[model samples]
Target: MGTKMIKSSQMNSWRRLDNSARIFPAASSVTTANVFRLSCVLREEVRPEALQQALSDVIHRFPAFNVRLRAGFFWYYFETNPNSPKVSREELYPCAPMNRRENEGFLFRVLYFGNRISLETYHALTDGTGALEFLKDLLCTYLTIVHPNIPLLSGWLDKPASPNAAVLEDGYNKIYKKARGFAPFTRRAYHLHGTPLPFTAIKVVHGVASTQKILAVAREHGVTVTAFLSSVLIWSIWQEELKGRPSWSPVAVSLPVNLRAIFDTNTALNFFECIGVGMQFNRSGITFEEILKVVSGQLAKELIKENLSQRNAYKVRLSRNPILRGFPLFIKNLVLRPSYRMGELTATTALSNLGRVELPKEYAAYAENFEFILSPTESNAIKCAVCSYGDRFTISFSSNIEQYHIQRAFFRYLTALGIELTLETNYFYDNKPVASPKGRKHKQ
Candidate 1:
């Protein structure tokens, strides 16, 4: 049996978009899907009927995710979706553009393929943290239903029958303070140039490594995992693209900071900001250690709470301006679409580290691993997402370009450091296997 549905009259009819999410609806297109995916691989193959019932039970618990995107006279808003969203089998490439009408007016979809259960969402819905929470609950409920005889620990799987009001509050609006100045201006950064993949295809490559090995490497370099990975990314770009070239632009990597860590809100809506970390390599013979030092130092300064608060305040202030708010939807879209494109040029690529994911010991035995994937844009042809569960640390690269130079460079750098990688890709041409070199062996 599934949980009962909440009546439409019991919930708010509509609500305004959060500060960071306001631009997604206007800027979303086929080229830039503005979508992301979170998947968990289980020990056993998925049962579609059980997964569907699990979604039915868990969907009503999260009111923020049970809504649809609706266009308003002045701005886009989320309205309560009266129909239930159904889970489907994964057929198309991951993170493809979502069609609202075909999806029953839902902003997100639940998908399953073999042992993997994935949740792909539109950016306007929520940030990665919020989505992970939802996935956690759904996974817990599904396991409980499927393994009825297994004894599980209490409190780990327990959740409130209904969501608190905090889950829907816009944290940005709640923590807004008047800003004294603007965020530091950044010059346009280097962009990756490549031949686009035909037929709107996406190439996904995942490099699975041991978490302890990577953490030890980061400690050896005296940097956090994110800092270490970002530095490696910058170094990869420098060596592969701009090593011997004379260019004024720096190789910038956009890092999305989850504000919930710094702010005092638990809203499941979008409440994160992207801060750019960049390094210039005009001169030759720049070592990897030097790049690490520069990236670590810059991250230290940019991640200050005061700096992030002021940046968020500035965006909130701009959005609340009376004159800007008065513009009609179409006019706002015209200005916003181009503004979004320009913002994309400020980063050579994006690297989002979701940090570590935790699962209760009772449930851990049933899970194999977890992955996070980011959608790529035309300007930023490749983006990376990092996630770890238990001993498995996965770095996934999603690219639309036909080149694998950067991906190869990244994993090779790690392997050269003595960290073995189990590489997997979705590139299937001429009937070749998905996992290269076959047998799922480590790439040394």
Candidate 2:
């Protein structure tokens, strides 16, 4: 029997998921969960009742966020969710599946552990940028409720800028240009395959570094922080390969581009795209200078308006095609899932940088750090997320594979460059050192 459609009858409002979000519903599965987490670590322990009340208040301000995913004959859409979000203590690991039944028909879940509050949302609900915006407001509201005496900066805890309609807009529709330029193609890149972790578990390793030190290094190399870090990742992965793969296999890094800055809209919807930075090498290893140069050039080329707009336009076109639009949901699922999986072949792994997060001076003493962790996908075994708050920059690596040589090599490479590092993990035993590519292991 088909599941009953879950929606609020009283609220006659619904929205089509944005262009980038269209595939998440069809592609999501138990092993390959499409989700991301935005977490805030506060100085004070969380109070559940107060946090719940704050969530209630914050939900009203961001209507786009209070949604439930629904299946229709043609496509999936989001309906207004009248039910209150179920708040719970942080349990299980991050990025677990959030099917409607598990999430109370809502697409996002909130959990708190000690002083940290986490907001994990299915990618169909929003991208990292949108999720981060919601997290900021939720944290602001929670702080206000918990510490009434603390003064918030002007409009710090307030709603987004005027025209709330813009907050829910399909930005791709607003900026898509029907050009003959085709969307970029994907070639088969190197894939990280190994023994799977037991219990479908995810292993996370976080390396905290000084933002200033990394920035200085990037500046010295005449590259942005992302280019610098991506170069290091590519180099690290190359080192792990050790000429094991065929000569054609390239070490590619996938990056999520925030379209809000490019597309002139403030919509808290999925307004981003992924571009791959790849480099193939011969039997001889590639130098760090060469990797950085290619990554810098690729990022500079792919992030421009011309490339992003054309890529997104292709997505909008595919979703709006008359014939494709009329296909039943089941057929669409069969078609989309395979295509999405094929697209995953373009990048061996991904790196999403959320940029800097600055809180109000009043709340600085109350907050510790922020993190953005990308859920490991089925095809992509490992992925990285980077974000900075205050002077601390955190690069978190999440993997589903039992072998963590790539991550260990990546962090060790950074420390070798004189960047001080501190490591953290979810599992207590994970604090131990990981085996290196040379069969020697050392703690970070």
Candidate 3:
């Protein structure tokens, strides 16, 4: 049976946007300086009926799912006129789907606009950590509706309603309050020469693996899988340069880290901070174990800092700064653009690992495979993607690195270590001439 419905007022600080629900500023133009990458994992066995039922059930549990912006703040509604909503999966295309209305925000976008149904969101509303929780509950509800025999673990289901604004904005407020003390991301970029080498990616998956299995393996190895697999990817690109794409040189690997869980705040906002992870592979002595150790150590330290929030807080502040507040968001994005960025790809591409998904267990079998794709930045050479089903890591990379040798070599190293991985190319933008778009601010 469906759970009780929630009133918008009862959901806290709920406001309404009286116009069509769409995320502008980011999508208003294709030439904006900020680049948001998209990730999608297509499961082989998605029961359509089950998925529909799941959406229907969660619609009440998360009233945010049925909402659309009337002005700027969030609002709750049992439903909107399908024809008047002006939102469909098409709006989220090339992006993941945005099925839930509450899931929509300034730094985020969610649209279910595909046949298989794709869930896409930009990096504004919240990071992957919050998104996963929403996904898990939605899937659980769906499974229950499809196969009633599966028992529901009520402990992990939706929380009861409340009216406090902080109740829904806890993490957001923490990050915002601490934003004044963080530092800016240091600039790091690699070069590209001649026709860029094209390395394709495949979506690989493993059936339900609890978060514990993946974390346990990492703990057992004394290193995070993100570190281990990232090490493997950096090496793979290095090898690719030696074997196939000879024209490329050494590059940096980028990783995006979510600070909410680490900071102990669970509010919803675009509250993620990214740090570029670089490795020195200029010589023959570098081993996967060594690189993994370094990467893992660095990430551990980055998360432990008390003042890291100040760095990214500036960007958010400037993005919504009240000074140029009147300028079209597009025009304002120019001044708001970061003068510097992360990820060293002189031969580099980014790697993003969202890590294992935690399911409440009773409905575990329903999840087939989970995958992630790193956000595509303005540069053609960057690509970051990762998703793990338990202890096994499914690694993927994005790059316009002119040399394939780096990636090829890294793949071989994993094979030698007996780490099972499936490499496939699911998407490519063709061999476009590689050139960094000149950075220019939008005119007000």
Candidate 4:
């Protein structure tokens, strides 16, 4: 759409996976799809042809995302995909496991349904920050093609300009340092029990609320938005699942910290680190305020740059170890698969906040909202993703479990706090129409 294209000269070359990306290829499975989605709801219906052309034009700019996953003798790598990427209609469930062969060997897919344009990608390709950049470019290109006369008020649409050396650089490897010790391994956390939906199907529930209202409430609590929501999630789990259980395991919520800002790098690779924040419920009558204080304090401590650097340095050191690098592909998979699964047991659930998304003034009028969804795993059946655009702050929950008790409790807790929410879901778990309570409405 910008009329200037930058192609990768090394389009036929291969590159090693980043430090954090190595585990995704090994842990990816039917249950653990290791895929995440970012969707933009526009004011009008999407045109497939225009979207396809936009992708073709913009795909060349993001060489990191335009490659296919390849298995090497000792590790997984990425090779440029020869086939052209295409836009498709949304046919399958959201965040379904990616099939590279059927998808032209690409690791990501662009889908459109009605007014929504969704970009779903394998975690190995990049983290949410990277994927969001690609999505923004795609949307800007598409909008430019459709509304050529609308002048953009900002320079945001001028991105995806050209791939710089830093764009694809592995940030973790670039900032590696020797650490005295690795972060202590977490003990097994309390898990929510529920009947699995047949066929590994995922059900998504999104609670949309006013960003300002939520922010005001969070300010009142003297905590960040992430900390407040996480406390609610932990409280919801306690109310719905862990309240009278005879378990000492903590209800830990894993929060993914975007290290690009902390480490000061612009590489669009997997550069985030997850730190678990939660509490072990020793007593039955714990209040949300109490949990919020603990969660806020833990976040403050774990989010420190020095602490994160030490933990990530240890991980990079382990990943680059000579002995581990020499192992055969099969042996590495054999070891990594189970090791990754065991790591899943270390957290009860994950909460990734993408923070605020911005758009040019002209384009903002055409976009209604945005959503981020995390794929669920067998061990951690429920995961949450949050992103805010305009005045809409959406919290989406993706789960394979049949029960909606936790989701219901979460929204109800917000409503009780005087914040309004508009609920929406795929309603695929039970295959029946579920009723919405008074004052709260369901979109689909």
Q: Looking at model 1, which ten-residue stretch has the lowest summed lDDT?
A: 435-444
Ranked by lDDT, the better of candidates 1 and 3 is 1
RMSD of 4: 3.8
Candidate 1 on 299-328: residue-level lDDT in tens?
998899999888888888989889889999
What ranges in model 2 sit over 4 Å off? 1-12, 152-154, 158-163, 243-246, 428-444
lDDT of 2 by residue, 25-120 (tens): 999997888988888888788899999998888876676777788898888998888788867887667788778876668888888877788898
CA RMSD of all predictions = 4.0, 5.8, 9.2, 3.8
Candidate 3, run of 10 with poorest lDDT:
435-444
Pairs with backbone N, CA or C atoms under 3 Å apart (clashes), candidate 4: none
Return the lDDT, model 3, position 345: 27
Looking at model 2, the pairs that clash are none
Deviation from native of the Cα of residue 160 in model 3, angstroms: 3.9
Q: Per-residue alpha-carbon lDDT of model 4 for 330-427, expressed as tens digits? A: 99999899989888899999999999998877678999899999999988999999999989999999898888888889999999999999877777
lDDT of each: 0.86, 0.81, 0.46, 0.86
TM-score of 1: 0.94
The TM-score values for the models, in the order shown, are 0.94, 0.92, 0.66, 0.94
The regions of model 1 sitting more than 4 angstroms off are: 1-12, 151-158, 428-432, 436-444
